[model samples]
Structure formats: structure tokens, C-alpha cells
Target chain A: MCRTGPSPDPPEGGETTSTDAAFTALLEDSADELYESAPCGYLSTLMDGTIAKINTTLLTWLGRSREEVVGRMRFTDLLTVGGKIYHDTHFAPLLSMQGSVSGIALDIKKAEGGRLPVLLSSVTKNDSTGRPQLIRTTVFDASDRRAYERELLRERQVAEAARTQAEEDRERLQEALAVLQQSLLPAALPPVPGMEAASHYHTASPDRLGGDFYDLFPLDGKRWAFFLGDVCGKGPQAAAVTSLTRYTLRAAALHDPDPVAALTTLNTVLHERYAAGDPRYCTAIFGVLEQAGDTVKVELASGGHPPALVMRQDGSAEYLPTPGGLLVGILPSAPFTATTTELAAGDTLLLYTDGLTEARIGEERELFGDVALRDFAADLTHTAPHEVIEAMTGLLNSFGDGLDDDTALLALGVPTDRPDTGSDSPT
Target chain B: MDIVSRNNVTVTGPQDAPVLLLAHGFGCDQNMWRLVAPALAENYRVIQFDYVGSGRSDLSAWDATRYATLDGYAQDVVEICEALDLREVSFVGHSVSSMVGVLAAAATPDRITSLIMIGPSPCYVDSPGYRGGFSAEDIDELLESLDSNYLGWSATMAPVIMGNPDRPELGEELTNSFCATDPAIARVFARATFLSDSRDDLKTVNVPTLVLECSQDVIAPREVGAYVHDVIPGSRLVTLDATGHCPQLSAPEATLAALTEFIGNQS
Candidate 1:
């Protein structure tokens, strides 16, 4: 402390040499002490990051003596392993290129295995010849900043864990819904004598349960009843309607087995079940295959469903039109129309939901309409029931994210040759 | 998919000459070959392109499902060749792109005639029988470094890095300042590139190949280069006197010499 100017008027204002001498002595004494006791830690290092000079405050922060750090350790050695790697790869290169970097957050390893979070700012000093000489650094204790960052990281981790749990729950729900959906449909189609039957149901999304369903079951004496239908919309509610529709169709067919009568019964059941706030509806086709003499007669009835396609052995396809049918469960008495078509040795009847015809064509909004379906079925005239189903399923797959709705398909074809009944004959 | 713009394909040099396709490695784009490509373009038809989500290429085309593995990058190379209708290509790949080249050759064997891998590593993380120059813990540290480094640079340079839509030189400048890419995309690519194991693919490379290993290279060490040379049947190994991972940037003449000699021998 220079007490040379403490008096009111510097009583010895004329004694200039004495005051100048005191000021000079004060500067010389305080420079080193001021640097040593600065608020922030100060250090100087060689160009290669070897520490050359360090102050008491930094040494105290690192809990190391001057002998241990100066010249014995690189500036990066004070950092933890990960921070050291970052220093080597990014920090050093950036310093060399840009000549300085500031506010770099890193964790410095203390002498006794504790960590000191710090923000470092460094500038490269060069000699008079403009060659790089040493680096001067100022490090600020960032313990509070580090704590804030860690709290932020912890909150982020908590949110991330919650998001992951939500995603897992959604996947589980999707799986459960898929299993439940599979249970609602028939496991396998019942084998009919002298006939081949194949069916496939394609759901647009693997996550949501679709409402498309189909089943082929035996009625009383020489007749087999089959129905393919799709409920409006999707998900669990639609799945409920699907289950109800499937069981009601089975029960109604067990009583009547006539195509129009069974559909009429289904329409009545659904209309009564959901006549309140939200009206439930479905487009369906009910068919029965029965043996007459030599050929099989398939009686099909439609309720706002696409007409069935009959492909003959001669490579010709035609839609057996069942006109004037309304959607099931819409009106109390939605018209259900029935039509009869004969299935000879080489005739195959194909029934499908609207997903196929309504699939988008490439990026266009235009649907894959009757023209495309006609072309697709015209080529599959000689195909068997299973082969036709396989080919149609492949076509649906070719849409490639364009088919945005669920589709159900059913194909019934008579055999080319009846099996000879010799020893086990029941005719 | 417009493969041309997706990979930012640039075709120059004599059209009828044998094609030299240059593919860059991680932390860089086609500009990594800036010094070396001009000389090669004088003699050969030079083709350069950036990977999707890299410099000047369409970031919109970066599909995680498509680029989840190196095969996706290999598919990019094959598609580039098909789009250009280039036959008899001498594929020049740097760092991780070496394995990508091998995959491309295996995919379209007739299009690519030879392979040049500079500072190549089949695997970065060490395995049971392999000395891949890094451990899983080291890779984790590297990943952390990447995260922190991106955080350090993105805050200051994001606008300059992303705003120069038409001028690609800005992107090159960003790369020079800080190896810049979209941070999220870069993280995905770093994991994909570092965690991959393509040691088995080296054996399937039926074409003539050359491995250019730099002395004192830290990213791909000498032993990893030798392993790549040993597995690739009849492939030539040339150790450049240059140092560091990017010889084309640090020692262009040495890198160019090795590349020209190899291409001449193949032709």
C-alpha cells in the first residue's frame, strides 16, 4: 500500500521524486501478487499444450501443488478422459486454426479423484516474428453452471424415458389388438368336397386392427356358406362390430343358409344393435356353394358390396352384377339382392372388399378402378382358387403404401376332376 | 428418386476415358478430393458426389431406414454409376467409404473395374481376433466428443452453415472451419460408420484393388490397413510418406501420385 498520497493535498506536492519512487515501488511489488490472487485461475502453456506457468488459485482449485502441474503436465492432462479426447481432436485444432477459443465447458480432474467443472477461454500468443509461442488461458469455476446442465440432462432423460415407455406401451397395444383381430377371423377354411377355396385378409396398418373378415363354414346337407365383409372404419370399435357381424352371419346361416335371407338377418341384427347415436354399417357378400347334378351352383347375395368376378377357363372375366343392394344396417330394410351362378369344372368365382378397387394408382388420386381389376382378373382365368388368391394378394402388395384400407378376399373354384369313389363310396 | 441430385453428382474430364469415381469419408464431402481430383480429371473422366445428408446434397433424401447401414451408401454409388452409365470405373474411396466401395463392387461387379481405398479400415472397434485400433469405450468417448463438438460449433455457425443454399463454397468454408453437417444426421452417420464391421466384405471384392495407407495415421492405423490388404485378394498396398487421416488435404501430391499410379496400372 502506497500511503504517499493519503494526505488531503499531498503535503509534499513539490517533492516529486519521492512520490514517483513510491509509486514505482508499489507497481513492482503488486504485479505478481495481483496475478496470484486473481478471482479466476490463470495459466500459460507451450504451443503443444504443456503447462509453463500457473497461479496459486488454479493450483488450489485442482488441489495440486505448483511442482506437479507446471512443466510436468499438459493442460489437457488436467481434463477427464473424454474431455481430453475432445481437447485433442477439436479444441487444439480449433485453437491452431482460429488462434483462440472461448467459453469451452469441460470437467477438470482434481488431484483426489474429484472433478471441477470449468469454462476455459484461451488465446494464442506469438513472438515478434509472428511464430506461435505460448497460450494464455483463463479458467472460470463452472460448478453452478455444471449443476444446471446436469439438472437439464436429468430432466431430458426423464422425459426420454417416459417417451420410450409410451412407445413400448403403444407397441404392446398394437400386438394385443393384432392377436385379438386374428382370433376373430376363421383359422382355416373348411374343405369342401370337389372344390378348392382360398381367402386372404390384408390390413392396411399393422398397428391398428382392421374390420375386414371372412369365413367358410358348412351348412346342413350338401351346402357350404361363406361370407366376406368389411365394417366401416377400423380399430377396437370396428373390431367389435366385425365380431358381432361374423357370429350373427354364422348363426343366421345355420337357420336359413339362403344368401338373401342370411344377409337380411345380419342387416336386422346390426341395425338393432347400433340404432342409437352412432350407426354401424358394413358392406358384405354372402354366398352358398351347393352340389346339384354334375356342376356346383353358387348363390351370392350382396349388400352394397362389389359384384363378384367369375373367370372362366377360356380366359374371360365378367362381373356377376347384384344390383340395387344397400349397405347393411343403414336402413332397417336395406335391400339384399341374391344372384345364382354355376361353377363348372373350370369356373372360379372371386369376391373382394373395396380396398382393392379403391387403392390409389402411384402418386395420383385416381383409384385402381374396374378397368384395372378387369385386366387383372382377365389374366387369371386358368388360375386355381389358391393361385388366384396368391396372385391377387401380390397385386395388392404391388400398390406399395398406396392401399390405405383393409381388404378381404375369397375365391371358390370347382375341381377339374371329381375323385373316383370306389371302396369308400357313400353315394 | 433423382439419384443424380440426391448424391450431388458432378461429372467432368474426358467423357470417353475410364471413369474415376471419388467417394469421401466421414466428416467430409466430395470437396475432400478438391486438390487430388483436378489432376486425375486431366487424364480420366472424374466423377465426384456427396453422400446424402452431406455437403450440397439433398438432406431431404436422408431416410433413416435407407441409410441405416453401409449398404445404403453402396447403393448410392451403384445408382450413381447406373445413372451416368459409366462402365469400367476406378472407384476411389477414403476412410469409411473404402468398405462402401467394396460393397458397391460386389453389388455391380461389371460397372466398377478397380478399387482404391485411402486410409481404409474394415472395422474401427476391436473384435475378438481383430486389432481395430479402438475399443468400445473409446468409441463411446468419440461419440461424446462428437456431441460436445457439434454443440460447440452449431451454436455459432449454424446460420452460415445452413443459409447458403445456392453457393456451395459456403458449405466448403463451413467444413474448413468446423467439419460441418447436420448434427443429428452426423450423429447417425458417425455411429453407422464407426460401429460397422466389414472385414468379411474384403474377401468378396473380386476386382483389382489398391490400399493407400498413410504413415502415422491415427484414425486408420497401419495394422488395420494391412488387414484390409491381406483380406482383399491380390490387392496392392502402398504406404504413403504423408501423415494424418486426410492425405488429400494435407499431402495432396503424395495422395495423387499413389492414385495416378494405381489407375494407370489398372488401365
Candidate 2:
């Protein structure tokens, strides 16, 4: 340290220089000890954003020389375009208003033109008269913070993309499952000349591909055959059984149109294929559609499936007379029973998968059972094919997401004598 | 009455490849550019639209008489530009749409920025001097095949469509996409599309041009693209390293890089 007066003895320590050694040591140590090893970057800025003073810590962090930043650049010049906007809009305003702001975060654009994120707290210094002197600030390196935020954003984007892809995959699977379930049944119901028929396969789960199927196909000269069945179990194994049942039933019907004989043949075939310990079986009702002028005959046979519901034109409803039949394919050649009923004009025959009657609605977990379905059928007997479908579909929809299986439906009815015969089916 | 739809136009980008108006080819709507549009969006205000009788555009606006000639499609391009208040447009055209762009560019030379054609051809017939690859007899056979076979699924084009799709069943979606077309009208459109000669008007395209040629394309030959390139003055030809009739489908990244560099350089 140099002073205007003559050199003095070093603070009475014998081996001396003529100065205050303590003050000299403090001045010398300030540059290397405090500036280089300071907690953060230190700088002084002019009121108009020019840089006046900077420390070695900041200089080293920015990879620049002392001459390059101080006097040559302003604090705003050190900011990137975005950083500058933040400085002008928020930092400068808040600092000017308060006369001092601290712990603020900003990026000091490096001399290399790349971004250098920093936490910069600043204060306006005062002169003796309390007039504003210069702006003083300390900058903490925020590279890790910026990188972390960028990674967080990238991760969020990837998660969002993955979520979208999963949703698409799930939707595609549902559509595929729907189409597979549909293919197990007929493409569309065969039009009968003298009767109305409606069928619904209530699904318990959308995710699980169920093993229930229904179809109304034209049989020979004046007959149409329809059937509804529930294959045992769930998932892919059940799907396979459903596929086998569909093809075998069609083949059996072609061999012999008699309902009992068709059921017997299917029983024997299933028994032969899956009589092992890991055996499988299903319940079914097959019927031959017969036209008798204004009346139709449904000679149906049962193999442990639910009985057909007969809703008369007179608004009367009853279960068809089907009794004493075992489940097909469970036993080796199980016996099936046949029953016949006459369906007069405006009469409807309801056929459905077991999911409709087996659904659990109340707190007791009691089955929905046959009575509710019968009542539902009684109300919808006079409605057209579409109305019947809509009513039944509404009932199933009321079940909500509770119905977890796949569903298939087919509806047919003899048209009423109106000028417009082409009334499209109901929603 | 010519029955065609006139909706589904979207404008997005830098507001700056100037305005590049794009028209899709036959049998598809504007959704064909889903993969490549985002890249072009960075530099150019690219416009994409659906032509009636295809895609999700309104079919009710189709008028048979007005749409009978190529001039009607040209008028639609001009009308859309005027409606959106677009000027100095860079028009991009695909197969059937290339000729439509040519006709539109000719009508309003001042409004066009450039013409960028992807998979363009003048005619489908085998002339005395020129070979468009398909003969008149071949095109007829193709049309007949379309009547019988196009109704079912085409595996390549299936996923590209976001709307009704034809699968192995050939029922509902088939009726919507292929069966919706009147066989007679489609046949007429096909004939008009394949038989037209637009080489005479190529020289008259005075705007700055860019021809994006897809390599190994069966529909639009490289030679044909070169022939068109020679006719248009001061036009830059960029041959993309890709195969198939659709570059936006087969190679999106390469197409994006090229368009970005070219548009940036030009700007």
C-alpha cells in the first residue's frame, strides 16, 4: 500500500517495512482471496446498465478476461435476448422501485453467445448524501437449474407422448376386439317374413373379449335359424372357444336343421375335443325359423342355456317351455331337449347372452335374474326392431362401466303396413 | 355439373416460405401431409386443403358442370387465395393436383411465389415422342381394376387415412371411401386426369419455381420431372433420396431438412 507521507516502521515488529502491514495485507488479499474465492459473482453496474466492476469468480465462470467485460460491455449486453427482456421488464423495474432487490434469478448471456443461467440479486448503493451511486449484484451459477428444468420439460413431453400412444393402442385393441366379437356372429340378421326377433349379448367388460355369440341366418327354402350362446370362461381361451362354437354350430345346422339334433352334434363334438381335465363347455339355444303365412314357428332346443322369452302381440309375456338340458361339451355327449312355440303377428322373441340376467346391481350382489328382463321385453314387444334394440341397449348402458365384456346385437321384425316400409332401425 | 368439395384449408408456419399453397392428389384429402407439414411450418406459411369428392371436405358443394374442366379447380385455387388475402404464394402440387397448380399459377402470375411440384406428370398415355409409362389401354384396365378391386383395402394407403378405413371385410369403410364415388363420375374424372396435356403451359410459368422430385417413383418418372425442369426458367430442382409416389410418407426427415435449408437460403 502506497501513501503520500514518508514510509513508516512496520507496526513495531523489528524486521520492518515502513507501512501498516495489516492494511497492506488486506488490500493484497482482497483480489486473490476474496474475489477468486468469493461465494458468487460480484459486479458493479452503471445506472444505464453499463458494467463498471467485476470479480475473478465471475470472469472465470464466463471464460473471459477482466478487460473484455468491464468498461467494454453493459449488464444488459451480457444478457441474451430473452434474458435482456426479463431484465428490462422485471428486474430493472423492481430494483428501481424498491431501490434494492435481492435473490432474483436471471441468465447472464456468456461472451460465447450461449446462455448462462444465473441467480442475480442486486442493490442500489448510496453516496454520503443518500443519493444513488451504482448497482451492485452477486450472480450464482444456475446452469444445473436450467438443465434440470429442460430435462423436466423433455420428460413431461415424453410421458405425454407415451400416454397418447397407449391410449391409441388401447382404442385400437377395443375396435379390434369389437370386430372380432362381431365376426363370431352373423354379419346382419336374416329378414324373416312373418316375425319380429331381437337379440343382445351383454358384455361385462370391454377389456375382456367375451365368448358369447348370436346369429339369425336364412335356412333353406322358407326357414331361418337363430341361436344365442355363452361359452364358459373369459379372455383368449374363451375367444378361441367362441370361434370354434360359431363355426361348428353353423356346420351342424347345415348337416341337420333340427334344433335338438344340432345341439346333440355340437355337444358330442365339444365333448370329444375338450374332455380333458382342463376341459371347457358352454350353454346354448338353437332354433329353426319357420314361416306359416301370418304366423311363425320357432322350434327351439336348449343345452343348459337360458329359455327364450316370448312377448305376445296381446301385450302378454312368458318364458318359452324349455326344460331339462345339460351344458354342451362338459359331459361326453350330453342330451338336449327341444320345444316349439308359435309366434303370431306383432309377437317378439327375445334371445340374449347370460350377462343380461347375471348382472349384479344392488348392494346384496343379487343377480338381475329373469323377471326384470321379462318386464323389459313386455314393454318393448310392440316396438319396431330398432326400438326394441334401443330399449335393450339403454338398459345395458344403464349398467354403466359395470358391463365389462363385449356385446353383439341383432334385431328383426315384420314391418307394419305403412306407406314407409323403410324405417331404419332405432338408436 | 362437376361435383367437388371446397374446404379444409389450413395456414401455419413462419409467416415468412412466403405462402406455399398445396393441393392433394386423387382419392385423398389434405391430411396426407401430417408428417411433413410440421417441418415446413417452421419457415413457410404452408396451406393444406381437401378437394371435394375426397377426404373430409363437404360433398354437397359439388357442382358437376362447373367442375367438368380443369379451369374450375384453377378458379377455386384463385378464390381461396383471394379469400384468405394470400399473395406471392409458392404453390405445391401432388399427382393430379400438379396440373391444377399449373393452371392456377398461370392465371395469377403476380400472386405466386413459386411452384413446387411433388409427383407431377403431364399425361398418362404413351405418345409418339413421350412415354408416361402407362398406355391408354393400361389406364382403361386400371380403371376397370379400380371398379372391381379399389373398393377393398389397399394396405399402403389404409393407415394414411384418418377417416373411414377399408379393412379385410370390404363393407362399411369401403362404401364410404371408394363406393361413395359414382362409378361413371370417377371414370370420367380418371379419363380427364390421365388424358390432359399440360406440357404446352409449362413454359408460361414465369414465377420462381422449385421442383421436388422423388427418386424411383413409378407414377412420375425422373425423366419427366427433368423435362419439366428444363422448360421452367430459373427453377431449382431438388431430387430427394426417397422411393414411392409420396415423399411426405416415405421420407419426412430428408424432405424437412431440404425444405428448411432451401427456404432459409432463399429467404
Candidate 3:
């Protein structure tokens, strides 16, 4: 009875049916198990965000029983407060409009007092009548992903903080350099009685501090010492040379009260300080102004500096030529020249560094030469000290980015009218 | 920088009609009004724009000092109105933009005719004897959440991070997503929007106001809407059946009905 010799292919239909029935049962059981223990958690919520059904995997991840969540808690209640707010504001509205929203990263509050990072994808399932019946959501455990992102964010914050600190340090260094540079210049030009005085120093580059300095301090016996000078190069080294030059000139002027002696003292100090290989040099003009009744007497000395301009009351400008001067701090005993000029009524004596004449102009990048300067000064013959400085500043502004060198301008004008009723101190 | 291009202003609808400026909230851009704006365009001259640092706005215009507070965003709104020469407007603001509109209207009352706040919270941090809804710790957690999400986004948004301005279509392609803000700007905006205390500005709203409160809105609750209504003089409060914070997207028809009724009644 047990099927001998192939047994007519073992009643093919009957055997096949038996195997198929067994396979069907196994497949059904496998599908059920697959859904209940899937890698991700699944949930179904009502249109109003009420939890209608949930799988075993979700309940296990939440550490809650089916009885605790279903019909008792809303889907949003399982989220942290901030996540809940974000859900209500952005997620829900997006889902309703687009019919689905996916890849939303939110945190779910555990049954205990903790949070679970999860990446949620949700879709609204509508009934046969097209009314949205429920929201079907799948949550993936994103703890590892969140940790990686947190690490990345921490690194980014660290880099950002370090970058900010570096920027602040650079800013502090720049500020210190600026204060040092300011110390090398006069806070305010000293007022010379019966003569109006104005000076301006323009920096060429903001990155590195310039080493151009100017000061007008009073000397004994109704005389005043004024100097405009430019040190070689820029930055800290040039700044040091400028500081030394300013202090030595003032001390030398106090002792001698002579323009040529003040220049010689500055030259001696620079040559002595930096004589060993790294020599420091400068171009300077030292002068003294003393009131001679209605006119002012000026004694000018030049040490490789540009010629000074004397603008007269008749709108004619001429160079107060002081030639045959050597560069300061070069040779031990450098030769120099002195020229004396008087500022009569409505006359302005302008002493400036070569930075004004060396300024680049136009597309050809040509120099704004001495001839242009003379012409500009001639046009402002009757201008007062402040007005002349203002016009010159306007001209500098018109050059735009073309003016690349530091400029120092010092002007002493004999006022056309009587002096103001204010005190002698500069405002 | 032209202010119009800086804020990515996009003007449409009837040219001669009264202005209806729709300002988007914190997390999204002007695209949030894609559905409702087209409907409102039938009657009113619809105006929409992306705030600087969001959408297609000029990123170079983002100054940390200028955009440090909500006042800066409010100033942008005023400037946009000025750029378009829009004298009178019915401002429809959703979520954080509601309060942004509040400040702008308070400052430039002559420009704004009616204020329609979908969901506004005058202050988000809770204090003694006040119910602003969230705590400081909760806000901190929100910031952390934003941080995590932004980190995730940066991986895919590499082109934007590299500052390749030539490929603007890359950003345009991701317009449908809700969280498409630049990470740095979003952090600053999150801090500014959530940490603001604008209770003092409520009484300064001189325009006719419409408060649209939704049911079960966790971001801006019913009490917050009621507080806004009570403080703002001659403000009308309507509790919508829409269940979330953004009724403009979820329940646009209802929002349109209320808006048209109010705007039509005003004329």
C-alpha cells in the first residue's frame, strides 16, 4: 500500500495540493512574523493624530504595552514638547497639503523620562470617499545617525568658535597697532597766535600701520617748532623709528631752538640707533614760525624732503626751494639746506611729504606731480587754513583708490581778517 | 544691494488692487503660500517675498548684526513695502511671521491696513504669572533638534556650503521640503524668533486685526491667541476648526473665507 515503483507519478495533483497547503500556511506565518518584528516601527493614527493601531515593534521601542498607547494616547503625546510643537506647526500642515511627508527627523519621548531619536516617514490614507481617514507612519531608529550628526555639529561649532577667536585676536592686534600709531602723531596741532594752523595725516593702507608723523609744538622766545616727516617702509620697525624721531626733535628743539639743529639731532639719533646693518632713514622738513608784527617769519630746513609751497595773497604759488639736502640717517655728517619764508597777510605756507605728489591718477596710473600741486594751491590763494585742508582732502577723496601712499600736510596761514576771539588752544 | 533683489521680492496679482502681503514663517519661505496666495490673487494684489538668507534671497546681504533680532526682519518687511511703493496693505502672516507682521505694523501703521495673524505667540519663554507656553530648557532642546536636523541636511546640500552661486537650481529643486533654510541663518533665526518678548508691542497695533486661532495648536495655543486678541484694541478673534498651527496650508478654504469676509467688510 505504500507506493511501489514510482506509483504513477504519486498522484500528481494530490501530492501537489498537500505541499501547497503546507507552504501557504508557512508563508502566512512568515508574513505575520515579518511585520511584527520588522527593523522599523510602524503606527497608524487617526486624522486628528489619535493613535488607532500600532505594531509590536513600535510598542517595544517605546517600552509601552499595546493597551497603554492604543485608544489612550495620541501620536503627538509620544513626542517631546518641542517635537510636538514642530509636528503641529510644520509636519501636519505639510502632510495634509501634499498627502504625505517623509524623512522628518523628530525625537520621541520614551515611556520613561528620556528621548529616542527617530527619523519618521508618514502618509495619510484616505477612505473610499477620499476623506483622509488615518495617518500611517513608519519610524526608524536614528540614534546612530543622530550621534554622528551631533559629532559633526560639535566639530563645526568648535571650528566656528576657533575661527571667531582668531578673528578677534587679529582685531585686537590691529587695535594695538592703531593705538601705537596714534601715539606717534600729535593729538591736536598747537595753536600759533595770530596764525591759523591745520594739519592732516592720511594713512595709505589699513592692514599695516604707516610711519608718517607730524607735530607743531611751541618753543621758547615766542617761537614754534613744526615738523613733517616720513620714515622708511611701514609697520612696527618704522613705527619705532618714527617715535624716536618725534621725541628727539622735541628735545633738540628745546635745547637749541634752531630748525637745522633739530633736524641734525633727529638724524644723529636714527643713525646711532640703527647703524649696525639695518639702517633706518627718513625724509623730513623742520621749521619754526614766529610772529613778526602782522606777518609770520618761517625758518625752513629740508633733509631730503620735498619743497614747500608758498601760496601768496595774489593767487600765485611758488616752491620755497630748499635743495642740496641729504637723506637723514645715511652718512654720519649729512649735509642739509635751510630756506626762510614769510607768511604775509592772506599767505599760506604749506609743507607736505612726497606722498601727495607721488599719488597715482587716471587709468594710465600717472603720478600726481608737483606741477599739479602748485596749480591746486594757486587756486586756493585766499582760502583759510581749514578751508585749504578741506579742499585738499576733497582732492584726495576724488583720487578714490588711486592714492596709495601716506600723505602728511601742514599749513600755516596768516589770517586775512583778525584772529577769532577764542583762546589760543586748538579745538 | 538692491533691497528688492536682496529679499527676493516677487510681486503678482492685480497691479491697481490693494496689497495683500503674505509673509512666510520661520521654517519655510514664500513658497508656503503657493496654494492660498493664488486664490487671494483674484481680488487683492498679492505680494510675497523670501526673507534674506532664505529661499532665493541674496545671501551676501545677510549681516549678523542687522539680522540679530526680530526688529531686523520687521525692518525688511517695511523696506519691501517701501520698495514696491505699497501705501496700504492687508498683511497675512503665519507662525513666526505673524509676530513679525505685528512689529512691522506697529512701526509703520500707515502702510498696513489690516493684520491677519494665523498663529502668533507674543513671547515664547514662560515667566512668573505668565503663560508663554515653553520653558527655557524646552527652547534649548528645540535648538538642539534644529542643530541635528541641519547637520543631516548639510550632507546633501554640499553645493550651497561650497558657496557655488552658479548652481542656484540646486536650491530651487528642494523647494517642496519644509526645512530648506541655510543652517547658520536658521540657527540665528530660531534664537531670534523663539526668544523674543513682544508683549509690549501688542497694545501698539493700531490697525484692524484678525486673530485666526486653530484647535490643538501646540506652537501657538488658544490662550496665546486670546491674549493677543485681548491686548490688541478692536481685534476680532475667530477659532478655526483646523487642528494645527498652519491653517493656511491645512485649511486654506476656511482661511480664505475669513480673510475675504474681513477684507471685503473693511472696504
What tens digits encode model 3's per-residue C-alpha lDDT throughout B1-267?
A: 487777778788888888899998877667778768888888789989888877657777887877779899999999998888787899988888888898898878889888989888899888987798999888877777666655224545633532346876565445235456667787788888889998888878888889988887888899999999999989999888877677777678898898888888777
Which of the two, 1 or 2, has more TM-score? 1
Evaluate residue A223 in candidate 1 and report its C-alpha lDDT on the 0 to 100 scale: 90
DockQ of each two-chain model: 0.11, 0.02, 0.32
iRMS per model, in Å, is 4.6, 28.3, 2.4
Task: Compare candidates 2 and 3 on TM-score and give the better one.
Answer: 3
For all candidates in order, the CA lDDT equals 0.82, 0.69, 0.82
Q: Write the per-residue lDDT of candidate 3 for residues A1-427, one digit (tens) a residue.
A: 1323544444467778677557657766686687788899989998777899898998888999999999988898988877776677557766776777777789998887688899988999989999788999999999999888889889989999999999999999989988898889988887788889998888888777787888899997699989888898888898998999889888999999788888888888888888997899998999998999889999989999999999887668899999998889987878889989899988998888877888889999899999999988888877788888888888888888888878888888999774443332221
| Sort order, DockQ high to low | 3, 1, 2
Chain A of candidate 2: what's the TM-score? 0.74
Better of 1 and 2 by lDDT: 1
* Model 3 TM-score (2 dp): 0.74
> What is the per-residue lDDT of model 2 for residues A359-379, given as tens digits with 9 covering 90 to 100?
667667677779988887877
Candidate 3 backbone collisions, by pair: none
**How do the candidates rank by lDDT, highest first?**
3, 1, 2
Q: What clash count goes with each model?
A: 0, 20, 0
lDDT of 1 by residue, A100-156 (tens): 777777778899888888888888899999876899999999999878876776697
Candidate with best DockQ: 3
Candidate 1 chain A has its poorest 10 consecutive residues by lDDT at: A418-427
